[model samples]
Target: MSVNGDSEQQDWPRPSSSWIDKVLFLGTGTSGQVPAIHCVTKPDFGDCAACKDATLNPTGKNRRGCTAAAVVGRSAGDKQESTILIDCGKTFYSNAVVHFPRNGIRELRAVLLTHAHADAILGLDDLRAWTMGGVIQRHVPIYLTQECMTVVEGMFPYLVDRSKSTGGGDVPTLQWNIIDKDKPFTIPASQGRKEVHIQPLPVLHGYFGRSSPFWCLGFRIDSFSYISDCHEIPADTLQLIRGSQAIVMDALKMDRHLSHFSFAQALSFFASFSPPPALGLLTDFTHRIEHYATQEQVDTWRDGMLAAQLAGKAKLSRSVGEGGGTKWWSDIWDERDNEHQMTIRLREKYDPIDDHNISQTASHYIPPIKLSWDGLVVPFDPRRSPSMP
Candidate 1:
């Protein structure tokens, strides 16, 4: 399936001056999230031993569900801003509120759907809260592939058949845009801001009912690529994701699964990949894989990757992103590495970005980076890519 955007292009043009500064991971857990109910219902006699500790550590990663993120853009002096939501799955509304400020939903410009699965599209209706308010409300735009539209219409007949009776209560106010595979599409940063292009790469998801294969998508926006929920990555899709500076793909567990990539399989795919992404991450983890264990695994991998780059065994691509930063190139031996180390600097004289004032609705970036107990947000840019910190 294809849309109004280019299906095949050598490259999606990067904004010469600036672009979105960061992509924040909203929730990184698999469909059931961590603390799976079955863990208790069916105890270790046959229950989840790995997730056993998730009960004691309520705020731990194993307690998570639904994976998504916010792609944020801002202007100098905070004159303009844009927030694009990737997917609003079943847990989206709950997770978004925790990650973003009160106005998070109200400020979204678009919603991109990777597929029609319940975990990926369930929270869609909750968007009505954003559309029903304000003196002048506007319909939110939703982007999806033709294959997705078919399943979506079947699932939410009310959303497709506008003619249906509503009995006066508000429903999702949306406008749908069909994206063409291998095609790149553009969305304005804001009303007068520059445009950001999103590249849609088609991937083959495993069969739905044992006899019929289905399709899903992964997207490349600017310097990063996000691939979720695919059992297989086709040759064409790999070609499309080749040049991303950072990539976050699905690796649902440590062991092989019918519908998702195990951690080893995921790492192997990119380890041998050409023009490998500078920083590679695995997401969409299920409770079966303990959060602490996965975090330790990722940390170990990062250490090894940095060691390889330092020893000249691997090449780390350089890139940079926005706000309170610069654009430059350097080698590992360069002393400038110290200068590029992320340091928080307040733009204001006295209004500090303390925990007290760190609102999700902040007009500009809070600082270079922010860490949390549940997840982490690492800033990225195309101009500078440093070793993992």
Candidate 2:
């Protein structure tokens, strides 16, 4: 599907200088956060770094759920500040409380939701606490896509219900503004002196049973775009973010899956948007692909992309993975090569097992795999026999 260019620009309010300085990446991840509830509740839950502390490494595993919000506008100090939250996942309330403390923010302006998934909107109730306690006394305006609003009202009846009396004198009230996909809207920022234009980019979520359909979306905030829980990135959406400074997207894992973009797919997507300032993969928290696997997957994809360039489909002129705190793409690729050699050397250290049976039989038996800086592989499996090949 393509975006209507005419509609996107028509009636668009001119951006003010005050709005330019605001924006921060609040949270990033898929619906089920890292170190999921099951992980923490399981009897044999090992001492995982993420499990040990929630704030130090706020990932999908350690955080409440997968949601990101950005705040916009200037702070009370009159410094230009504007933040926008991409998704409001289950732990949004607590995460927000910790991340954006009362002393830190002068206002909690708008919340933009990417989709209607549970992890994205479950924290709607928590805003009430902020409202009731006189923390954010003013009505907070929430902007959502029309499709998302339908799902929100259907899923959260109480929040949308105007008749119910919130026992706490006056609960935090929400003003909903339905955003038209075809048209862009400006949110008041910089203490209402500036406006930030938000454009909705349509994407495909997993299909529903037999005949029904579900819609997912990503938002383009000026030069940055955030898309999570999507299987495919539509061409039109790509066009909208053609020159983005950063594109934060979902890279579920290494292997191909039916409903999500595997790490390879994510790399392909990044290649499609070649030469972007930076690209970050989020919404990752699966045991199948541990931290090492995630980095490996990234390396594999980068290598593949580089290889494809020989045939001319890829023409990356700048260094990849360098802009972000992530290592340079060349460094990662070099590491991958080193890792391959190390894997060969360690071959005798691991018992050869069928790939298909590895998950069912040896997943838990094996310790976490570590990827060396030069790309060497070390099998931490204690079950390895000296005679093993």
Candidate 3:
């Protein structure tokens, strides 16, 4: 299939100018991310499944690092169009530059942070470079749950410091807007006269054994909802996203994970919701899985089994109206696997994408590269590859 370069920044299966506005899955990998600096350094490091096969990776000409999600509206004549970002992971800047270049994005209206994990928020520094160019004059509004804000302040003291009189630092010139979990709020849209309502849907993070109640918030933008780093979906939260046109969520692979959703878990979650017009998997992978092998093997498996079952047995219907009753067959699964060992089966009639396995899966199988024995094959050492680490 011919890949669309702008699909990550534009709405999937539809153009950006579509009725529901634009929702893009900028970055979907897990904490360590794919083609990790560690994995990339290995001597036998070959091509990346997501990059070479999935077609989800950006073009070779302009490669930015990290993962992120962006939502843009269709309002015209608005100079400062509002663009919202969820989870500013370590690769935020490079990912932003690649998917949303300075010229493409006119304004950086707000940011909603799900938690304080390094992969989720380290890219805040890259905003410093954007400010120097004069696109943003004041601190951009950063929305976070009270608990998450505390974690950010503790981790990146300089960025959240309210004491700095001059407001000059590596931070992305942000105006902190701390939000309460489960509450809906309004953010000014592209046109100052208009505003977009965003509802924060809270979910769990981390593993059960070491499970600390880390707060992760998903945003409901118009008909689209974005949720990442979640373990379970509460009934109320599911209600909130019931009729959403699209849901960009975390599918950490096919394995049964302690914290995140496995492919089966994600599919189960998707099954519960009224099928949205589109379904894209974000925060979709990790580094332990073999990109190439997984994609080919899983696609073959999905076409033969999962797709047939869904076509034959899935009873859920899609919602009706612009944002009302659900339609059973409109469900779309833009599955992005990131965890290890997780495998997903597509519903019957759905043709599995070639790069489906580029992301993570719940299955615990190790990649060929990592299975080497001493002397026979040298293990990949991160210290040797400067591109990574």
Candidate 4:
């Protein structure tokens, strides 16, 4: 659990010329998505409040698309800011139709894939809109691992080899580039734009068989990292992203999931970093999680950690296990004791008082670790420490 090192030494190598400025979350839901058709159409079914809200309000927080985002920034020598997309999941078209115009994103500099899952790569054909029957944009450069590219090749033979396309339908034009998990590569610069440095972080999505792990690629663009689908992060990856300024991670639900990080697991990993990341965003949610409700839980957890840091000691627990076995758990601010690991739970209520109303100052506030919603635009400055936007 211990990934702490000298904070100064853990800083990612800064981009020589270009850097990412912000990330736009296009989708935050799991593969099935929210307001699932089955749940809404079930006879006399009213069990899920989140899905109900999503159905009633199309653009509400409860409504979500498959997890994906765009890294937006201005590379040196570019006439305008460029947007590099992270994933093109099943809901890519749905998300793009909304967020692209909403954010004024006109150019797609590149597309980076995490894995070859249906939710992650099924939207490959949707790029036709961008290509526009050979009218607007030209061929887009796509980067992915050999395994992911192999899946794309089989699923989209026409895209890889346009000769296979039949019926004279206009297909998306693409130039494929194979990426390696161990190598740090550069996003090929568009006209007048400089190349952007990227470090690939291969994580365990699940397992292929009994032992071999299903690898997914996560990317680190300077101090920001995005891992939208992962069950476990290896020691090397952990060390590589130890002092990230901001991270958009996968937390599928409150309970443990076989292929995604549960709320507890994601928080534990965040706590492992010294002083934690400046901003920690949890995404890839299921209908089981209500947006505001989950944010409240994260707020409570943050308050508890802040309290422990202020007290300078682990607080005593009220409950005792069988045979008078008392349980103690707390999260320290700077770093946890490497010899022991603590399991922290969210409190029903962290503080009754309204801290915002009582005082405008946030001297004791811990960095936010909260859930992300669809169409959420998180702006950050790579030249400085991240702050709320």
Decide which is better by TM-score, 1 or 4.
4
Q: Give residue 142's lDDT in candidate 3 (0 to 100).
A: 82
Per-model TM against the reference: 0.71, 0.65, 0.67, 0.82
Clashes of each: 14, 25, 46, 0
After superposition, the stretches of candidate 4 with alpha carbons farther than 4 Å from their true spots are 1-18, 43-45, 208-210, 315-366, 382-389
Worst 10 residues of 4 by lDDT: 1-10
> By lDDT, who's the top model here?
4
lDDT of 4: 0.72
**What is the lDDT of every predicted structure here?**
0.59, 0.50, 0.52, 0.72
Model 1 C-alpha lDDT per residue in residues 288-307, reported as the tens digit of each score: 66655455544444334333
**Higher-lDDT candidate among 2 and 4?**
4
lDDT of 4 by residue, 278-352 (tens): 677889988868777767766667666555544444444574311122223332321122112222354332343
The true-versus-predicted C-alpha distance at residue 209 of model 4, in Å, is 3.2
Worst 10 residues of 3 by lDDT: 370-379
Tens digit per residue, CA lDDT, model 3, 170-242:
4456678878888888776543536656788777765446536655777776666667778776667777775
Error of 4 at 236 (Å): 0.6
Q: How large is the C-alpha RMSD of every model relative to the true structure?
A: 13.8, 15.7, 12.2, 8.8
Q: Stretches of candidate 2 above 4 Å error?
A: 1-25, 37-64, 71-79, 166-170, 189-192, 210-212, 300-389
lDDT per residue, candidate 2, 167-284, as tens digits? 6535457778888765667776555445567778777777766364466777876555567667766656666765554455665644555556655445535543533432334444
